[model samples]
Target: MTQPGIDAADAASPRRIRIRTCVATRERHSDEKLLRVVVDPEDFTGRRLLADPKRRLPGRGAWITPQLSALETAEKRRAFPRALRLSTAVDTGHVRTYLAELADGPDIVRKTEH
Candidate 1:
């Protein structure tokens, strides 16, 4: 069932993991460590922010560290619009709420190796 020179593990492993830079901290991290945000087009005010944890949203998106401090720093520096390349203002309230919920959720207990 195996090819002459093919390794099954190599075929199963991801070819490449995406790396994203946080707009707030200007630090590089894997896509899993950051959250993607996009402008809420449905909002008539065009200033609302939407958290795209799944990273499936269309159009331009900005990456930020999944921490309250990082979100605050991005807001303070007004980095969303610039990162998203949108001229309209962006409201990060939704993102803040999402992060808060994540923080308050039950902690995952990791199994320790003896």
Candidate 2:
């Protein structure tokens, strides 16, 4: 059960939902409906992007709706670099692969729903 005031909504709110805005669509969505993209942890150049479904990666992150169209729009409009405050060219290859897997792999287990 939630404390009296925390996440208060008649005490029936199981948890406070995190809302994030999509850089691509300029729309607000709950974290559950968004995909977070961050600079790859292993890349110091800060140019390569990684799609973080788990939302656990460290660094500046940009949220986008988890859809192919949204991804394409963000990439086409070059929103990541601006949102991430990066001056270098941003690459989305890794994130593309992750989204592809999500589209094709029904067996894939998503872990951050809660």
**Colliding pairs, model 1:** none
Clashing pairs in 2: none
TM-scores of all predicted structures: 0.79, 0.79
lDDT of 2 by residue, 71-114 (tens): 89998998999999998889898888888888786785768966
Local accuracy of candidate 1 as per-residue lDDT tens digits, 1-114: 556677887766737888999999999999988999988878877788899999997768899999899999998998998998878777888999999988789777999999
Using lDDT as the measure, which candidate wins?
2
lDDT of each: 0.88, 0.89
| TM-score of model 2 vs. true structure | 0.79
Candidate 2 weakest ten by summed lDDT: 5-14
